[model samples]
Target: MVTATALEAELLELAGAVPDPELPVLTLRELGVLRAVHVQGTDTVDVDLTPTYTGCPAIEAMSLDIERVLRSHGMREVTVRTVLAPAWSTDDITPEGRRKLREFGIAPPRVRDGSDPVPLSLGPTRTIATHAAADPDPVHCPHCGSADTELLSRFSSTACKALRRCLACREPFDHFKEL
Candidate 1:
């Protein structure tokens, strides 16, 4: 006989394993999108999720997937809630997600400490200064593992990714933007 607590544990594990539709290479756990999972009652479970973007279409897919996973496990009443407060930040992405992004030929958002140096310049120089902060951290070339890279476009195939070209490997790739 499976204990309620034990079942809840299993449910949590299963929910964590749900994959993101946009970034199929990473699970919700790695993406840090599964906020909470707990047993609501004898036959009920509740799941809290934070979407990468508020308007992200992937959220709907992910919510449906979470429900499917729990219902498949025999949960009679499953609730997948979207939590908008403390909105999702790229920093929320787990280290595993970062690694997966790199493996998938997408550079992960760099961590920011708030103390990163900001340059002061005006006129055309302001454009250059802002550009420097566009990617506050080093954008390593996913193809050749070199730090030499250039931002080809602020937009990519997805709203959250920017297009970048690697100087070393002369390859183009998407960079997961920082929130």
Candidate 2:
């Protein structure tokens, strides 16, 4: 028989399997939203989550996904609690999560150094610049690896991303804006 701790671990693993509704390529873990998992009893599991953004519609679906995954694992009495304090940021993204985002064709958040120039190379340049909304970076095209990407629209399919087109590849794709 699995101990309560073991059951909690299993539930966490299952929760990690549930992808963010907004970013299908990213799991709740990748988004740093799955805060904690606790086993209330032999049959009950509790999960704590933080939303990526306020008023994000994905939270509803995320809650449903958590409940569904736990139920599928035979944990019928499951509760998902959401916390709002200490707002979420791209800095909360784990290294593995960043790697996943890169593989998914969305550049991870740029770490700024207050005055460092924006990295212009796709092959690892070491400089940072503030990614303020008023001073957006020259986002590279994820598909063709071109620094010659231009913002097609400030809004994409989701609020977290922007639509961009690669001048070299001539491909339109979504760029995860720095926030």
Candidate 3:
């Protein structure tokens, strides 16, 4: 007989392997969206997830993907829950995720130092991270592999990306802004 712990481990592995709909380059584990996977009983699995941002439209799709992946793998009664506290940070993105982001022509965020640059504050007593909303850091060129890039706009095709133009290759690309 398979122990609950072992079953849960398998379930977690399966669920964590599901890729994000918006960020197809990274899996839930690579994105650090997967928080916890616990077995409540012999047949029930519970999962905790956090979104990249509060208004991220991909949250619903991610949740549904998690459930679908688990069910297709023969697991039943899987529950995916999202939590907002301890807010998600770009630091949560894995090193693999960073590599994948770069491979996709989108520069990944720099290593986080516990200081996030998000604009909104959860509430009083919460130290809100300050981002350079106007002029952002100089982004590197993912095309020609040069650091000579100029920030065209702080916003990109997605809320998490910044538009940049490479001076060397004269190519335009998006930088995955670190949150």
User: Which numbered prediction scores highest in TM-score against the true structure?
Assistant: 1
Residues 61-154 of candidate 3 have per-residue lDDT tens digits of 9999998888787667888888887888888988999889988999888775558465643344312222235335545677877766676777
How are the candidates ranked when ordered by lDDT, highest leading?
1, 3, 2
lDDT per model, in order?
A: 0.81, 0.75, 0.79
Model 1 lDDT at residue 172: 90
Lowest-sum lDDT 10-residue window in model 3: 122-131
Query: What's the TM-score of every candidate structure?
Result: 0.83, 0.75, 0.82
The residue pairs that clash in candidate 1, if any, are none
Is candidate 1 or 2 superior in lDDT? 1
List pairs with backbone clashes in candidate 3.
none
Better by TM-score, candidate 3 or 2: 3
For model 3, state the Cα shift of residue 114 in Å.
Answer: 4.2
Write down the worst ten-residue block by lDDT for model 1.
123-132
Q: Residue 169 lDDT in model 2?
A: 73
List model 2 lDDT by residue over 31-125, tens digit each.
Answer: 88887788886778889888877888889899999999899888878899888776676666778777777778876665555643444434322
Ranking by TM-score: 1, 3, 2
lDDT of 1 at 124: 30
How many pairs collide in each candidate, listed in order? 0, 0, 0
Mark the regions of model 3 whose C-alpha exceeds 4 Å error after superposition: 1-4, 114-137
Query: In model 2, which range of ten residues has the least summed lDDT?
Result: 123-132
